[model samples]
Target: MGRKAKFNEGVIVRKGPGKKAKKTERSNFSKKLDSQHQKHRARKRLQKIKERQDKQKLLSEKKKKLDRIQRKELSKKQTEEESEVESEEDESEEIKILPSKGYSDDNKLWLKPKQKWIVQNENINDDESDDNGEGDSDTEDDHDDVNNEVEDEEEESDDDIEMENGKEELDDEEDSNLKVENLNDLSDDDSDDQDEFDSENEKSDKDVDDLLPIEKQNIKLKKKQAKDQKLADEEMQLNIANQEVFQFPIKESEEEIQSLQDVQQRIREVIAVLTDFKKLRDKTHSRSEYLDILKKDLCTYYSYNEYLMEKFMQLFPHSELLEFLEASEVQRPLTIRTNSLKTRRRDLAQALINRGVNLDPIGKWSKVGLVVYSSQVPMGATPEYLAGHYIIQGASSLLPVMALAPQENERILDMSAAPGGKASHIAAVMKNTGVLFANDINKDRIKAVVGNFHRLGVVNSVITCMDGRKYPDVLKGFDRALLDAPCTGTGVVAKDQSVKTSKDQQDIQRCYNLQRQLLLATIDCVNAKSATGGYIVYSTCSVLPEENEWVIDFALKKRNVKLVDTGLEFGTEGFTSYRQFRFHPTMKLTRRFYPHTHNMDGFFVAKLKKFSNLIPKSADHDEVTEENVENEKK
Candidate 1:
């Protein structure tokens, strides 16, 4: 060591290499570990955590014991006689254990457990307690009691917020003997500390036991009673917390949440409770108590997070939110479009009708569309379908092509066309006369487009697999274009339930960014002035304002394009302004369809006329804007 030090006295020393960690040490679990081994490790980990919690509890109890002893000593020095008299009075007071109505000796009012006052156990006897497996009957009883109250005559007056059925001071008709103490300190903070608190109280009780005569030997019985009382208190506190926060919120102003996990009118009832909590809730309950119940209910019923629920709440009115959620739970009606290039609509309808399919013309606005009410044969596998008479699609899917109004013998671009539903619709409208470029980024998806084109007998279309955003670099100057942009699938939750919990704000942002880029590319690909068409119909199967209005507004600012009517009929007008974002007054020309209102998948379609071909050099979509959105149409 001395010789090495002499070699470089002023040189800085280098750090040794990091020690290698085993897979078990570095990661939570190893792939090599079997299921049984993993479960054993988890049990051991939980045991260690429990030991630590017990140690902390003992330490806290020791500190509390020391403080209590000191307080007793100080009190004795001030008033020894007063302390004796208080103990005598406490000894005289009896702990009468009642399993039923909680009336006092003189028949005073009882303060029920605010959260679970409605739930009661008619058979909570000694035998039931011995079994320890009959507790579910209690909750079942509570459900029946709440249901009865909900079905009773509606509350006309705003007075009884605490569920009093004309009983002078009683909070609820169902009551027990959970000592009617102060209801104000009903916080869920110390529910887990009941054991520690009970131990401390029992120690003090033992001191009183030592002073009593030997003839009165019911000390053990008293201890058992004390333990039972503490158990009831702990159980009551847990009932107040996460036992389906929606369970009680199920009971609302008009109806209880009921089978909906309080989901049905649960939305309307929650809205009513939230809007007027002061009139709906008791004086002791906080506003968060109601909201937490609503959030938990929404999560359980819809499989969405609290953040997404808040976003939906902000977008729709309190009443509309209910309709929207209920609609998402149900399936959308089935519809299909006739391939004009392959067969006539009347001929196809007659053939399908003869095959035991119950269907009707979609609407007066669409001649080639049919709404299928019932189909005995598989709609996708029928002979007419294989011959390509109609393509299975949603009713809302027809709007964008109708808006585009593709003409025969004109060049057209389907910027994001995949699976060729809309692209084939476009080709059929043109009667296979024009050159149609059906481009999609995904190669696998374009296969479906090609298959549809061939089966539908669409002769005048070309397919390419390239990113839609790069279209301006590869191709340009089309007579008309359609960008059915990829989106968060917010409007189609009824079809794909996974979207309920899977989507969030980041998904929304990602979709909006992509839509803005693709829409701009679509405008760039279309000619400013064409004899037949100079339009781009932008669309998505999404209802969010961010993915719909926000993307269109951003494109308007970047490209020389103006909004035009979708040209068919019957859809809610797009918002000219939303939250802090504003668009030109003509933004109303865009159309919006909803599952609840239109009985279709949530959708949006906007037709824009390109006025010039010049594109802005640089524009960022990340900026948060707060522009004027005043006097928006209802």
Candidate 2:
């Protein structure tokens, strides 16, 4: 305590020295304040740096958004360009390229020519018996015509013709030498007055817009200018065409052409099946009876008798087939094939029942077929369709598969299996147990076949995309085969109008060759073994003899295939034999369902069986004779 008191009171230094020490302490404190101020300044600089970064970030974000919008616009433009290119490509691809298949290429179907009989006016010469009488008759006819023409010209000269017959008559006969020179001056005065009145009326209408502002006035002025220009153009046309219209002599052929049109209109009035070539050749009926029957049937089904008559005349231009078509009874109880691929027959029937579609099952020696009545509900849009349970097929389409009668566990080939209607049916007939090689030349149609198989729950099918002619090489020997040869679907003309537009003899011939080749390929697939040898069904939707019988005959000679009796109720026995079947549009209980007949699509189906070991020993070896080689070289 004593040392502390001495330090506080007695250990005092000199005043000057204490003052120097205090100054030093104050200098240190001032140095500390300077460092604190420097630190605050650094913190302020850091804050300014952070603020500048944030501002830059905001600008970058705005720029990014603008860039995104520009990119979207650019992308949209690119997409439009791509779509345009794709559209052009699609348009180009729409034109079908003919395949190199020799069959279809040779058997191209052609349209029936517009047959015109040259009228060989048989004026018996006999040095022309009684030439004076003929000459006098001709002169008298000319005199009568000239007199009538002169009278007509006089009638036209009378101004009363216009008053009596109206403006249309005056215009029609403007070429007649009526001599209206006196009326021209009056017509010109009337035209000038009309133009002046129209201009005055236009000016009066403009007053309503005169009070408007300049912009509005300008808009109105543009519209008025457009209207006035159009009026002036029309007036100019009228002034230039003031001359009278001309007339020409009425032609005899013109009258005939008009008559044909009238006949067509009359035929449309009848609603009968007008195309039954087979019936036309029948010897049992009279021509008048045929015509009356056809007329009656047309009247029964269609409302337009005139149209039916016209079509009848056009179809039977020479009246050779008219009697036959008229007499032939239109088929009853139309047959509709069940698309087994999409749906089952039983299921479709039930669905139809639910939809109030009256369907009656056709019986005896047939697979699934039906007689369905009309309905307000569209059958195509039914739930059964969406479920892939059924396809609206033709009874004739069912014929080939039924004829083949595919057995379980057999390998079969279907050439040209597009739309898979028949392919799926064949699978069904095989009880979904056999291996099916279904092929089509068209790749786009492949999807349809696959879809059909999927819907049908088919498991034993392998779809291939290739021309049917090449199928023999790809798929070797099959147990059974079906070649629904591509023909000019003449049998189905009743359903599609476009088919008729392209129908011709040349087209049928092309189809014939294609059918023959397809049949040959199908025959190759047929096995010549087992107790019941394999069968091949060669079919077409064609009615031409060349495409049908001629093709079958050729195949018979080439492949030694025997025709099997179809035992159908509708068609007459085939022209060649009972083993072959023919279904005419006019026949009863057959599958050639014409609109005028059963109100159904036209179709044809033929079934043939391949005998075991039927191929001759010589067939195994090449028989290229010198003559044949020469012919080939030629």
Candidate 3:
């Protein structure tokens, strides 16, 4: 038999595995019942949640519908009211009558018809017509006739009222005349009373005035006596103070006074030592000592870099260096160039002198140049300047165009032209006959060129806005070109003092590279040996050798161009050697102006001649080779 199971309190029991199996089945059945109950509860909860959501959605939609219906009703009511008001206004206009001539008389009291009664009657008629569509036209006509008769009667009544008012006015006039007569009599009596009162007041016032003078004299005497007594007391006190001071004079401490005197003497001596160059030189006594003295002097006296002093010493001798330092410290005079296109230099000069402006010729190089010594009026805003009779330009800036020497009927390019100072000068030199391509990179700056071109009456010029270095890609074969490349502006420090510290070595390198590119592009754009002797003028307002000679040196190696003489007689030759850098030997042909020597801002100008048969390198061959490689890959 299978294993038997014993029961604790029952009479019979099943034993072992079967009994345990039975118990497990019972437990599983109970668990399934519990699971079913839980599932039913969950389903009921979900249904309740869904019902609540549906109710909320229905409520919201109903509210929105109600709001829309209310808005429509309100709008309809407003429209109906507006229509009613419009109809009432129309009815009133139809029935309204103009005022009669009798009512218009000034003596008559006019009565205006009450518009409210007319409006109320019209409204009642409109309501009655709405209740019954058919209305009696004859009745309306009769009512209008009655109204007209009433108006006629009212006009007659107004006429009678005006007649009565006229009579009343006549009576009032008569009464006013009598009243005026009585008022005149009363006024005469009042005048007599006032005369007597005035006479009595005048007598009283005369007595008071006669006594016031004596009283005033007595007060004046008292004030004078008090002032004299006060002055005498002050004089006596001053005398006593003076006597006390004379008896016992103030004494300064001898040591402190002597120390102060010594301090003043030492200050005077130090000032003398600092000012006297001979004393300073004697103290130094040698080349190294003098070098140290110059470094300190440049720093303290000029507020300049010691490096600049060293470089200047290398360029100039000791005797000349002092003169250069002195020259750089002074202010430069204002210089202007007369526009020969509009007026002669002599005539402009005379006109300026008549207006109290002192003038002097700048140099023998430019005949139209004038240096303004003094002026009572603003030179720039003068009638002559506004009329474009002259261009305000630096004397140094005129050198490049003079070196270019563009002739009439020849095409020329002024690269980097802005504010058109030099470009306009070129046009003037060309006599406005040639096609001068005035180009600038900045769009805003180009507007200035256009304005100046128009002002100066330059008809042969065409303005183009483009980079100077990119001129080679778009333009070619110019008779002449002026590339006034941008630079560090160190040469114009006297005019712009901020330039002294605005740039550094890195800035010089950047300017040098840009000038090189622009110079190369300018050479490529201009013809080398045209019938009119094509040439390119490269210029900068920089004093640095890197931007001047070094740029030329680099271009000479890369291009088939030769540096030629700029034919500027006033400036010195360019430096072939600067520090460790040695430039091309032909760089000496270029011109460099120094402020100390030339009495102008330092400038550099190099004239270049391109070879006649020269050609630029091509990039087509590389492109073709790349295409072949791609075909092979395919």
Candidate 4:
């Protein structure tokens, strides 16, 4: 039909255009090569996976075998030791019970029943005394000590009186030899002097006898006072010396540096300096210089980056910053929220108490909260937990849901709900009467909500996985919205200490930008004209103002919403102005909870009442997004 092939090297061309050229197709060789390459890759991938799994299995089995051998050896050793103890017991004579004085049976008398004074109250101190069987012995010993002291004093007084009487007799004989009829007037004068001396000596003797017992007590009191004064003086001197240490005291400055190279003592010295800068730090150094060194020491000690330390110092006053840092290191109380849908708080607490769970109601501020001080059973694996009677949640997590105040039959949306804490709370508050859409971006995170919702029997929840920024397109017009945005987790450092060194300024900036975007989307998604409620609760586990106040301020100008009280009974009022940044005066309506002050995670909650759906022109954000929405739809 057409001219055949051109003779150019390995190129065949259809020269005539009689028929439309067919689309070029891969050669059989190339197709076969691609199939072979794909098969090779798949096989290689499977082989690598199998090898890794095999290695893990081998390691695990080896570890189990070693553990089993160790356990058997330990059991054998324990049994041998126990058997040795039993054989020794069999060979030894019967043990005799000794008296409270630790008396042996070398010359023991016949046994007789003895009386012990019964304690009327079960005070711990009294119980300890009774347990040692020394209650009566201690009292008798005290009485004996007093009697001995009195007897010793009486013996000394009697010896002194006899010595004085002998001295007077010798003096009288000497006077009788000297004065006779040699001088009659001298005798009268000498006799009068002797009578006066005798009268004074008798008066002194009478006073000594009267005050003999009390004098010993006075001496003992004086000794005790002297010891106490010495201790006080030593403490004062030590404090002064501590104040005079160079930078800080850790053996020597060089040794201190060497000690600091080790983590064990570095943190100790760092905390000491932070707690008592005036006393623990060198007096020669200026406060500013001390703080500079302290900042570095704190970073090294607590494993924090410099930026986060500066951020906290800026947030709190100089004195409270250490408190906040210390609080971050301590664990928050293990708290659980009772599920009212299934059980009452009283009944649930009773059931847990019966199972040897040491618990108490959390505080007056909460009706459904319980704090678990100790537990014989794992918190998450308890029968009551499996039965869905309660949830182990942070006390701070309860605040956002409380602030949102979800009502019955009202549509609610948890824009970033995962693990379903706040969402379940909202569902319970609504009594499962209203629809709740719990959406999170991560599919893996959404899986957690599934377990919680099922366990808690939450019926009115629709779990969705999508970007919160794109929430408005699929689900619009929520009666109320809760945005517990992802944050730097500054408030929950106690729960996750890795946040200290892992976070940076860039992280804060990234979180700030994300929070702003999410807050705008949250406000836009809520139905401002709802009859019952048009509230949005914005909260974060971060105490940073950039993630909290600044973001809230941004929303205030961009959306038609005003700040309102959270209705929570307690929390520090949000900062109206921090450092150089000033926020709306009504920012006080927002609440802050801190670990140091409130004994909870550092949290911020703000309730905003949306009056209208219209956004401000200053928010070119909505305008641009709206145009994009139209373009995408078209």
List TM-score per model, in order.
0.56, 0.45, 0.51, 0.65
lDDT of 3 by residue, 516-592 (tens): 77887788898876889578898999877778887888677667888888887767888888767788888889998
Instruction: Compute the lDDT for candidate 1.
Output: 0.71
Model number with the top lDDT: 4
Residue-level lDDT tens digits of model 1 in 1-634: 4545487778899976555642335556546756888899999999989977876675566557556655654564346334334543433322232332422222223222111232233444443233222223333343353333222111211112212221221222124533333445533433223334335344322233222233124655666799999999999998977444232432453253347643645655666767776666555667777666666667767778777787787778767887988898889888999888878889999999999999999899999999999999999999999999989998888989999998889999998888899999998888889799999999899999989989999889889988887788998879999999999888998888888778887777767877877887889899997877889999999888888988888888888989887896899999987777777788888999988998999999999998887765553532422111111111
Give the Cα error of residue 481 in candidate 3, in Å: 0.6
Q: Give the better candidate number (2 or 4) by lDDT.
A: 4
Best by TM-score: 4
Q: Model 4, range 1-634, lDDT digits (tens) per residue?
A: 9997767968777677544676667666534455778899999999989977876675566457556655765564455445444554343232223243422322111111111222233333433334223434533342343333333433433333333232222233344332223233434554454355335333223333344345647856876899999999999998987763334434465344644456445544555676777666666656676566657766776778898998987788656877889899999999999998999999999999999999999999888999999999999999999999999999999999988888999999999999899999999999999899999999998999999999999999899999999898788889999999999999999989889988897788778778888998999899998999899999999999999999999888888999999999999999899998899999999999999999898999999999999877755766745654554454
lDDT of 2 by residue, 9-63 (tens): 6666655656546654344433444577889999999998997787667556645
Better of 1 and 3 by lDDT: 1
Predict model 3's lDDT versus the native.
Answer: 0.67
In every candidate, how many clashes are there?
3, 54, 3, 0
The reply for model 3, stretches above 4 Å from the true place, is 1-293, 305-315, 613-634
Best of the two (1, 3) by TM-score: 1
Candidate 4 at residue 7, lDDT?
A: 70
Error of 3 at 185 (Å): 99
Question: Candidate 2, which ten residues in sequence have the lowest lDDT sum?
Answer: 107-116
Specify the poorest-scoring 10-residue window by lDDT in model 4. Answer: 106-115
